[model samples]
Target: MELQQLRYVVAVAETSNFTRAAERCQVVQSALSHQIASLERELGARLFERTSRRVWLTPAGEAFLPAARECLEAADRARAEVAAASGEVRGRLAVGAIPTVAAVDLPVVLKEFRRRHPRVHITLTSAGSDDLTEQVRKGGVDVAFLGLPTRVEPRAVQSRRLARGELVAVVSPDHHLTDAEMDLRSLQGEPFVDFRAGHAGRAQSDEAFAAAGVRRDVAFEVSSADFMADLVRQGLGVGMLPAAYAPRFHDLRIIRLRDAPERVEYLVWGAHPSPAATAFLELVDHGTGQARDRPDPDGPAG
Candidate 1:
């Protein structure tokens, strides 16, 4: 039956008078009586026994009263929850980021976000740039920090540039070209340590190498920037990494590239984000989300 029908039944049962129940419900007595009669016919049982002086519940009314009251209470709670969600930025937010970007200043931004909206439960996931971009496109994650090789023209989703850096060559401290500024062609015969083939940074490295007409031996491939940096430090091979990420390792020396790919980090989100995600984006737009863009002096800036 309808919610109003249940409400009318409960009110009549509690008041024990049809006129009093109608007054309590702010409806005319005749309308309330007719609705209760319709509910009884639908249930195939009389709900109340009425005499000239007063009214009393039948067995069906007694059985249905408790359940009717419970339904009303549940409806009230559902409405209250929707109202609260509309008014407050409170919920779980799943944010995605690539490893290199994560190490720079993403953590600091999230820290400030949590401080302002304590009710938002933040879950930060680190993945490759391609994977995170796919997740954002599929609506699997609320927002993401994506490293795009080229400038992104927004379409299905929105993007705001949070930071930018140029890709640089990383090598061991004692390597011959550690202190030299060179282009991709200089590493022609050197063993290279690079990210996995499908990764965004790796794709950029491939493009730069192809443009420079250089072919270096990929001696090692790893998914993590830390691992790549360690391999370079151990003299296994040289690595092409973002300038913002190259400083994470102490034993490695960063060299500016003559033609390095520019990596633009973006704050990307769907067209309509959740309240919590929207609030976090607002903090970023207002210059409070730790907007960081430290370009290396030796490399081209975005």
Candidate 2:
């Protein structure tokens, strides 16, 4: 019924130990236990199942957990907004990016962001686009640089197109595909090195081949672009990688797929993002100092 009670329940659910939850809440074990009991009594349902060695959430507790966290997060965001209104940009900004995209000049953007908002703490995470999108949806990440056609549910996040480039076929110098521009169907019989299924770029590659009505033999499924490029360099198989990454592999030949789809990047965030996230978005929108000084859609200039 009360915020404190909700906090206790969430802490217990997270720690799975009442004593540890109480310690995290900075309260005595008895007080925390009493509050949880009072809450269950008020709700007329047991929230947790307890045994000597472990604690687990009941069905009711599982259902209540998300709402409890949301309520706490909203409260924190309200405070963060007031801080932002005071022009004090001091909070953590959790940013996620796919490793392939990170290989691009993302460091430049991050440098500029840090230079302008030095007081804001930045945490960067590298993962596949699917994982990054999911992190953004669950509020684990404030914003993410993701490959386009994001796997995250549309309603849970919004995306702005950042950049678009082509996916090039990377082959060893001796490989036959290196000789000329070719159709994706030409690679159908070749052993290929590809991004793992469900990867952001893999979706594009898969769709391209499927649309062409040809099936390729994927000999290696890799998680990182660099590793995939290495495999191609060793003549293990051809790889489809972002064009921007072509320069990274000196031994490999980068060839354009006559009909391959272009790879796109998006800046994705939740519907209601933190102030630090909004500021980053603004910085991305207006890269120049003069342009950044211009007013945004919401109100006066930031």
Candidate 3:
């Protein structure tokens, strides 16, 4: 019924322990229980099922939890917007990225973001490019860095291209594909260690081979850049990585793919972005200078 009561319910639901929930809410167990009871009485629904050993949400509680969280988020955003108007940015910034985001050094950029907006809480998630794009579109992520093949674009969300580059082949020093430069056909019939079939990273290679009229085996479907490199180093299969990114594995030989697939890095955000998200876009685009016109909810997301 009230915000505090909702908070108590949410805390309890998340921790699934009355004592832990009270501790999280900075309230005593009795007070937290009383507030939840009061809220339950008001709504005429039992919000939780309490056994001595365990606590879990009731059906009513399950139904109520999402709206309660949304209310809290809305309130937080309202406060953050007020602070932003007064020249202070305070809100949560959820960032999503694929494993190989090479347009900028992420640690360096995140460190800078932290320094500039100390009050904004930040969280980062790593997933496939397509998954990151969907999270951005759904507002689960505030901003994202994505990589997709040249023929594709992150649709239904606002996106800006950061960089476009080709993927180079990496072979263990002992492999017999000795040419310094080769097309997709040169690597034909060779085993490849690539991203999972549905992942955007894998799609980049898949599209290339399909376009070149070649069918190759993705012998090892991995998700990590280091894992990809490791497999290639052991002569298990050939590895493909961005041209700029492959140099980090110094021991491997880099073969320029004359007809390599091109991947374009994109920076994406929701159409209606938070104040903290707007501030971040400004920082990334304009340096530490004054805030620029971006993350405008009224503006196009792309």
lDDT value, residue 5 of candidate 2: 90
State the C-alpha lDDT per candidate: 0.78, 0.78, 0.86
**Candidate 1 Cα errors over 4 Å, as ranges:** 1-87, 102-104, 151-155, 289-302
Model 2: worst 10 consecutive residues (lDDT sum) = 291-300
Against the true structure, what is each candidate's TM-score? 0.66, 0.76, 0.91
The lDDT leader among the candidates is 3
Q: On a 0 to 100 scale, what is the lDDT of residue 170 in model 2? A: 88
Give model 2's clash tally.
0
Per-residue lDDT tens digits for candidate 3, residues 1-302, read: 78899899899999999999999999999999999999999999999998899999999999999999989988889999999999999999999988887766677778888998899999999999889888887778999988888778898888877667788999999999899998999888999999998889988888889999999988899999999999999999999898877888999999998898988877899898899998888776753432221222223236
For model 2, what is the alpha-carbon lDDT of residue 64?
Answer: 84
- Residue 103, candidate 1: C-alpha displacement in angstroms: 10
By summed lDDT, which 10 consecutive residues of candidate 1 come out lowest? 293-302
> Which candidate model has the greater lDDT, 1 or 3?
3
Question: Model 1 Cα displacement at 163 (Å)?
Answer: 3.3
lDDT of model 1, residue 23: 98
Query: Which stretches of candidate 2 lie above 4 Å from their native place?
Result: 1-5, 22-31, 41-44, 102-104, 111-140, 149-156, 172-186, 210-214, 249-253, 288-302
Model 2's TM-score against the true structure: 0.76
Candidate 2 at residue 288, lDDT?
Answer: 30
